[model samples]
Target: MRCFMLHIACLCIASSLCAIGDDIDEAMRKSVPPQLKFLRVYGGDDESMPPIALTSRPTNLRRPNIPFNFSHVTIELDIQSPTPPQMFVVFSHCNADWSEHDNSFLNDPALLRTSSIDWRIAPPASVWYSYTGTLKIPNEHVKFNFGGNWKAKFYLYDDPQIPIAIAHFFVVDPRVETRLEVSGDFYSPRNTVYSSGAYTIDANVRSVDGMNDGQLNTAVFYRLNRYEEPFIVSDISSYEDVNQRTHAYPLQTMLAGFGMTGRRFRIERIPAENEYRVLNLADYSLFPRSNAPLRMLTPDLWRNGSFFEKSDGGFMNTRFIATGDRDYIQLEFLLNTQLIQAEREVFVSGSFNNWKPDPSWLMKWDEETKLYRLRQWVPRGRHSYLYMTGEVDADNRKAIRLTSEEFEGNTARAGHTFIGLIYYREFGMGGFDSIVGVAGGSVYGSW
Candidate 1:
């Protein structure tokens, strides 16, 4: 009898500990303030352009390029604190894969950080966010000496060690002429049936005066608006392979040919996902200022194999919003699966989150309502998003590989902007990866 009572007492203690753990998790989630929401980097003149900088004037005027000036890679964010938050920006020169460069010549640690940020209070009617912050790099405090992938980390002035937010951008000192071509005659190796309408991208790099053909053996591609995710194709097979534990396909390289002048890299079996679903919050009548959470008027339905609407190529537009109307709204998203349950985790990804499938954006399955629901705070703008289904990468908790076809569908007619970057393994300053060439083109257009 005493043993039985002890067992019951032990179970009660375990239950209490589990309850405490649950409460702690909930508290941590609640502690994530909206101050770090919607951190974005774009061109100074045009927010639609990618966050890429060109250090030199283009010699070939006809080729498509990342047109933004080196000083115009602007970082914009919103802070919801009562008073302005003391924020600082630190710039890190990164390798082709975004790892920080250790060389002092490439990454000058002393001159790459700043505590200056332009802050403005929100309009009187703005309730969700209190302040807006903007910072343009290559400014007075910081400058870029090397051309490569870059990351701008935002940190609180008090807590300088840990970054609260990070934004990816590019600085290019173009040395080669790159041409990009997109073809639709490709299929995924792992999932051929679902990816029957995949696209193939070929990046042809022509060596210029300063380029070394042997070192230029790698190319990375991005679906313009989804800059955070890169499709890397390298001469080294191991560099192209994905993490074995992740739900991602091995590097989809069709060819990587070396030539006397330059190199040609081809990445095939790229899923041509359907056009993005747009969420317009600029219309005051449709999305009026509300003290309570605003729910999507209509629940999102799954588009298994159908797409009709034209999209903005995943660009977020805030030009139509009034000055006073620019504020964050508590938006509720409801995805009605029509009683069909998802086999993997479902997440809503968009330009708002840099197209990343963050666990915070995960949808909860409602058995009673037979719907997937998520409530999030979003800014007032015209945004594009998609419903994604995939598992969180076990190796990298911050990364996830999602398939749009499982919920959004795939189509050959869907237009996408592709950016191809040529990487050269520069041997100067103990070796660093440099982007020597850049090309941009649309799936339905010429390079």
Candidate 2:
């Protein structure tokens, strides 16, 4: 009787496997390849929210590029809508009175052209019912610890089952589930009313990954130094821009710049609940000249604010003399391994080169330095940049799509050789979110 029961159990297991295999086979057989394929790209593996970039450094920036005060986003769908009866899901962020991020995702200037941008999918239909989509984020832009506001919607045309169910998902950045550290120092003080000084200020930002990536956007605040008050004055300091982590990074190329002589100083974190949240201290007399290399926050405080020992956390108190003469600008950036000959081609293009792609700035293989590099006396503090690698071969004349290629997801070696990122199965979604990614690292930046 025991042997008979065992045989029955084996048969059940075999049947389930056979069913799964049959479903895949049938789905492909009936489904006709649609003209276009909907693709979602992000740095990390979070399907719901933003993607966290696991790739060590910033990879090659794709065609549509990264611009200051703005980001380029794109998503292609393979649904059966003829005109694709457009519908949109949005997160209307009040980032700068809603200017930089305008209501214009529908007008993607660089839409994938015919044939070149393959829209092939299995089985085309007249209408899409239960559709699914993916969201991509930059490497820097991460979610808040307790979750933040990220608006999303679903726009399906002519579908009676679900016409326009604008789904709103407000959840924390993926890091909340683990032990994540988000800390930084302020170049200037946050609430003091004071004039500018001959001091240099900068901050370092980072995230938790197999490789180190310290880059983020920080909201810096300035006020009069005399009376510790949040200065509402319209001085240059008051109208200064924010700071980023990747100093002189290709994303911007240079760090952030803040050159002003305000009476006092202070910096504020932006976006999250801590935006403009004043740094906590018993008195405003915390700014003093110390010869020691200042440790911003105590280990425990930075690690996880301790038992009120110094728990009122905000910006780490980092300041320089208020002498209003020196280059007060600060350049912050993230450093990933430099590009190699095997990975990408180098080209120098910009207004400096008559808006032409110059060969001089073309990266040279630094055998000695062991890195591909281009050095320029960038603006003192911070700036943005782009790394363009023109088309390579005939088939890959445009962007390389690993998803198009059928590889078993083995792009690298753990113990042996250092293989590049999986180029085949990994869908290379074009947009700022495709390469380094905007989420989970730094969302915004200014200079």
Candidate 3:
């Protein structure tokens, strides 16, 4: 009788544990927002670019305003509920490395947070999302007084402490002159074929206000349309380097040179990867609106050393569809790997996800078909993407070091834009790092 009673007790405990697990799963599901996107609008174009802007100021006699030079970004997202929830956006100023600034001069919380997002019902055909919300920065509700890396945190009005989504953008108040140069001369640790395509980038920054050279000791380089990750170079040494993994040079001594009011930052052996592959979904006749997921007409074949098809650097084009007609479609991507085998896990990176290789985009290898397949719901547009192979970093699971060179060949002729941002340490207002200049150049032409 005692044994039977103990067995009943074990069953009871098991049932309680299962109930707890269900509750936890439901909570996690509710915590995640359906979809959130931070987009920079260039005039009437809806294509994606780095969400960067110059600090706004009134026109003056000395510097007359230029036509079509306005810079601001919009935050768009979908809320799952039919009734719009009370959402708020809070802004914070960040250092060059993206760490939040603690000083009030750099970040004033009271003036930086707002709950004035415009919400509207999703299109009639949209099924996954119910309502859409949009908020533009530097609007009447909030303004960016300081320039640097900025973070926008979205939160529910009731639960102000926790953020449901976060977006990053940059505000630059150009106070220095900057120049960037790219050349096809560099050395790589890889073999001859890989080394042949390596390029070197040199960014020269000179202070216009006669600032000390030591104050202009930091700078960062980014490939256009790939703003989430940057190669940061700084002279400051700390016990723990925050950007050790993404540093342009392994050591500070590798910096090109320093002058009275000028600093040069150089990064060599950067692979000139071939132009991105294009996935055009703008033709409504070819890709009609449908309830079922649509598969590509042809499977993507593995390209090792071959290159074809010209493409936009890494931008998404959504201007073809009208504002009311814009919608998301479920896309099935298949990569044929019958000719070669993958040594590491494969993922699809594209402008849709800001070229981020998140685990959700991981392609599953099908043994029966010898293909890597991934089904994702992407907005209707033309997107540029690449197939990458890499593992997640052990130290930081969120940081993945994926490369496309193994599948996508590299060539110097492939035009790519490199943007350089000059960082200066301002000793005023308790001292904070700020972007004083911005410049960009392309290997084949001007960006």
Candidate 4:
């Protein structure tokens, strides 16, 4: 009956999603390919901090925005375990477009063999027990001779078909210099009726290497912050220069919606530290599921667009312990949705679920309590989460269209970051896309 109850619950939410509107069908079809599921995944230059529990890397290390060879970034993975199985990480090459490329570069022996990976057993830690694996590109076992797009797939060593986790990274040769200019604007230029905020991107590329033909055979890819999908442009007319070394592509329409800000609540904050305010998710016993709509954590003081600033002000804290053991907390999330009349579905999302709107995280409406609620075995740690609403498209997947702004309001202050990259492909000679330029930055916004 438990399985049947869950199925009914999913159907109810899925039905609500499909009923939202006609436009959502196209939006859902455009959903980017999902990443492989894993307990934890991290990537960055060799010198960056390793992935740990109870925390998320503030900036994505996988899509490095720095001007360096794509081979410079390394990926690390920690697979969740009951009894861990042997696993190996494999790399797949992609074209300037994110589609998989059927080129010989991926068939190289160095990448085909298991010797390229440096596997290690995770140190006994307070949060959870699992095996960790590392793969550094351009290592002795495998080297990325040419660059385009690369995805590292983790699979069982003995059974390659059984996959584990997946990560995306980049490599660049920097043959061209690219400049990006971003401006904030209303969603529509003519009217401000439903205005939140939008970004207009203008890009310019110039040949940095005298031998290169520059923007003539290049594609520019731009993404807002860490989003997986990229806005791409590749037209000779977009180039401002005829010698073809320089090109400019301006946004015809502003990218709509105020980018959702980071989570304001700190579930992982240490209690003894007077400066930090946090909800203690350690004791499920204290908060049991009851008829009176068990008031879960204290009524959250909605702080729109607020972010944490630790003493060190570093990207993440290395010394903080997020959880005590492998045991999970049966935490219930409660949100008052009485004022919300739209036929949209709501979800709780954060770094734990790769910032994606997951079905498991979907919240159900309670007619009696006039609230949306979900119960899950969440591990104790500092969790960053946002209350977002959207439809579960025909794909049965959730894509956000409305955030907590209904209650939280639009006047939240938060930081927004953007990353830009330029890719090039020569006419002949294996025709692989190579990175030529990179740039990234953050902007602060209120309302």
Clashing pairs in 3: none
The C-alpha stretches of model 1 lying farther than 4 A from their native spots are 1-34, 56-71, 125-127, 186-195, 236-238, 242-247, 394-399
lDDT of 1 by residue, 206-293 (tens): 7766445878867888887787677888865544653222225544675445545567888877777778898888887888887579
> lDDT per residue, candidate 3, 1-447, as tens digits?
999999999999999999999999888866765445323222212345556766665212232222213367766666675367778888888878777768888678788989888888867897666677777777787877556788889888777788877877777766766777877754342344332465677777776656676678677777787876676667765411644554222323235555675778876666676678898889887788875899988889876545678777787787677867667788999998755666677889887777766777888988888778999877778888988776766664543656666667676777678877777777887887777777778776433
**Most TM-score-accurate candidate:** 1
What candidate 2 gets wrong by more than 4 Å, as runs, is 1-43, 47-106, 109-153, 158-447
For candidate 3, which ten residues in a row score worst on lDDT? 59-68
What order do you get sorting by TM-score, best first? 1, 3, 4, 2
The C-alpha lDDT values of all candidates are 0.76, 0.24, 0.70, 0.45
- Residue range 1-447, candidate 4, lDDT tens digits: 999999999999988877775457656643422222234333344222221111011112233234333334556555444334456667776765556767774545355445355545544541333444566655555555455566667776555774566666665554545555555442321223222444444445555334344333444443221233344444433331221221111233222111121111000100010111233433446643222333465434333334354212111122233322323345677776444543467776543454456678888877777777787555444444556555554563645433444333222123234455666655554666666556554334211
Give stretches of model 4 more than 4 Å off. Answer: 1-71, 106-129, 188-195, 211-225, 236-296, 299-319, 322-330, 377-383, 393-413, 444-447
| lDDT head-to-head 1 vs 2, winner | 1
Best by lDDT: 1
Model 4 scores worst on lDDT over the 10 consecutive residues at 265-274
Please report, as a residue range, the 10-residue window in candidate 1 with the lowest summed lDDT: 242-251
Mind giving the per-residue lDDT tens digits that candidate 2 earns over 1-447? 999999999999999999999998878744543222222322123222221223222232221111111222223233433332344333322121111233233223123011112222222221231123333332133221111222233443333234243222222222101111122322221212211111111222222232122212222221111011111111232122222210111111122323221111222322111111122222225422222222213211110111122211211222332212111111111111333242345442221221123344454556764544554311111111223343223541322111100001111110110000000111222211111111111112221
What shift in Å separates residue 264 of candidate 2 from its native position after superposition?
16
TM-score of each: 0.86, 0.20, 0.83, 0.62
Clashing pairs in 1: none
Output the TM-score of candidate 2. 0.20
